[model samples]
Target: MAAVFLKLDRFALRQFNTAKYAGTRIFFDPDTFESKVNEYYGERHALETEFGDRPALVQGYAPFCRHLFMPNFTGAKVSVQRITAENESLLRTRYEARRPNELPVLVRFFPSEALGGESALPVARYLDVILYSREQCLKEAQAMGEEPPLEDAPWRIISIKAQDEPYETPMQPITIMRNSLIGEGGSGVPLCRKKYAEAVAYWRERAIIT
Candidate 1:
């Protein structure tokens, strides 16, 4: 199977809470999701202004939803792997590196023409967090009114070296859909990460997640 990996800094980690100890995983209703996207790119841009350029932490269209459109409370499917030696040195550096090569280049996913809150849409698409097209994203953003542009959005550079494997399966074709649901739930009781095996066993016994 083809898979795409995403590296998140501490800020993105906070929103996803992929790590059980990171605390609460945010509940994004379109609006909050857009806000967080804007926030992330904004800070990344700041880091870029200081440093000349660097490679992006994540590559390929990501933020995939093998389960949650964003992710759920326990962050199932989003496992935390060890900081690879290959990617470690670049991940660890001063807040504002004196040398340009010390940090990675921060960049925005979309163009300046996107305008208004329209910017967040492209960022979402870049992460594969959004399955819709540029047109669809713009439509949604239009309804939301004018907001900060992608370059202008206030958002981060957190010390982190986390890996998120999105596609356990091959990529699927994208189509236009009217509405969708994204959120939290795992039966009546919300099982913690520790009970993962038990939950899987229960589901397998019933063929729920087979």
Candidate 2:
């Protein structure tokens, strides 16, 4: 059976989990979830090579891009909420003493009406603030263990675990890599996890995973 997912923005949903789906206003659209997963995974050979030597083919998918509208390769976007997480979601972590530039992204919440193909705000357990440039990243981000220079990509995502007191400064960092989610996509309570396990198992049974 196709599992249910809130019919919200897919890029922002890299932080997907049940706590973010708390309210009744969100739609559980299996079709949309399936659709996004389709783009993210692409064809079987594409997955094996990670779309190797064919950046344009992979960049054609919105899941692997930087643009808010869709389809580009500068980077990808993710969203996390600023609250206590209920389960083992991305909210269970924090960032370094670094912060994003003051430039704001879209405001997110569960929408009341059908987005109908319109983009809707996103939700997650923690907040992933994106810094767009190497210069800005140098100014705002704290260096960790001589990590490589910031990529030429526009979306530098930092997953920050936050508090409720209206959000203070000096954000910390912990990573939740998107490529790592290829086959590890369950983040919910027992029932939700069960359904997710069922879906993954179904695909595996068809030789999608070895």
Candidate 3:
């Protein structure tokens, strides 16, 4: 099966709620999305500047879809995992300190250029959907003081990023994709970090990347 991965912040969580609770799919043009990312980067950069100006880890690429991409609402194979508040801190630590060997393929899936919101995006090629069991969905709905749906249907959280600020309340439960180290693709497009390194080395050996 084709598997895609996703990451969710607060805003993304909200969008997910809309999809599951209200049944809507929010779409954006590439330019508008890019603007939002730039605005966020500017705000974040300003705050970081106050602390101490440092070089950026990613220079040109916008940090917009660092986690997830969904190709379609239905008929897509996806894996989901939720980054809970408890593990959030640990995740941050690990992300910062991740060794090449430890880094997962998703985190290391850097594009050659920034994804400028093109229509023919990677959603079909390399995206994952978030799914939840019926029980989990009902539990979350009750927690939010909302009535759960009558049917015990599974919930598929759509792709959305959290807002610039932290979410005020606890989020509904969600899941993330499992780590996929190697997947079928073109030579330069291996699925995981180790294989990515190998591909890079292979290309360098063949004078592909100098």
Candidate 4:
């Protein structure tokens, strides 16, 4: 069965209507539509392809870029309670220690929403995060002995393991984003080894690991 994805944007969900579903909120066969939306958002921001050939969907809880405004991402955004100035500084330090020039974006809590459409099977919410430059992410993928990222590809979605903390830093020498779980649809788990297994088991228990 084709994967079913829930549209989590609370403000406006017009973008998720990839198939022109006559006002349909849910989407079927989201592969092409996801690619197109990611591409549109990438180009809208004039995002440079520094990492991979092009921008790819960042399927995660955080809104890594403008294209991703779903409830899951937005809900996490709302859940981020204000941190103490000292703790905030420390987290910033931890992030900057890895990426000297970049900062990590924090997202919190996953959304609890039903999949409304033909495939109403507890759909997971996906948010697209854009890693503008593919240099570091691609290199890490290669070091894992995975195929080098395709040349000049339109976009590449980076995945990571889910975490209670929604903060994400750019891919750097330590590799904030690593390649995990090679799948048939070029799928991967973006989390580090620490959380990869946990994410897999969680999804499997819920029968969401497709």
Please report the candidate that would top lDDT against the real structure: 4
Better of 1 and 4 by TM-score: 4
Error of 3 at 14 (Å): 6.5
Residue 162 of model 1 has an lDDT of: 17
| Tens digit of per-residue lDDT, candidate 1, span 53-89 | 4422233222221111222222233212123344233
Error of 3 at 114 (Å): 7.6
Model 4 TM-score (2 dp) = 0.29
RMSD of 4: 15.5
* Residue 138 in candidate 1, Cα distance off native in Å: 7.4
TM-score of 2: 0.19
Per-residue C-alpha lDDT of model 3 across residues 16-62, encoded as one tens digit per residue? 31222111223444334434433444554576678775421122111
lDDT of 4 by residue, 1-210 (tens): 322222222112332434321111333334554444444554534543654433333444323222232223221111111234433332221112112223342322111221222333232243333332244335445544555554453333332111233244222212224233222111243656545555544432231111
Model 4 regions lying over 4 Å from their true place: 1-31, 42-67, 70-126, 130-132, 153-155, 160-210
Where is the poorest 10-residue window by lDDT in model 1? 172-181
Of 2 and 3, the candidate ahead on lDDT is: 3
lDDT of 1: 0.27
Ranking by lDDT: 4, 3, 2, 1
Across 45-120, the per-residue lDDT of candidate 2 in tens digits comes to 3645774533312221123222112121112212222332332132122221111322222222322232221134
Best by TM-score: 4
Cα deviation at 32, candidate 4, in Å, is: 1.1
In terms of lDDT, model 4 sits at: 0.32
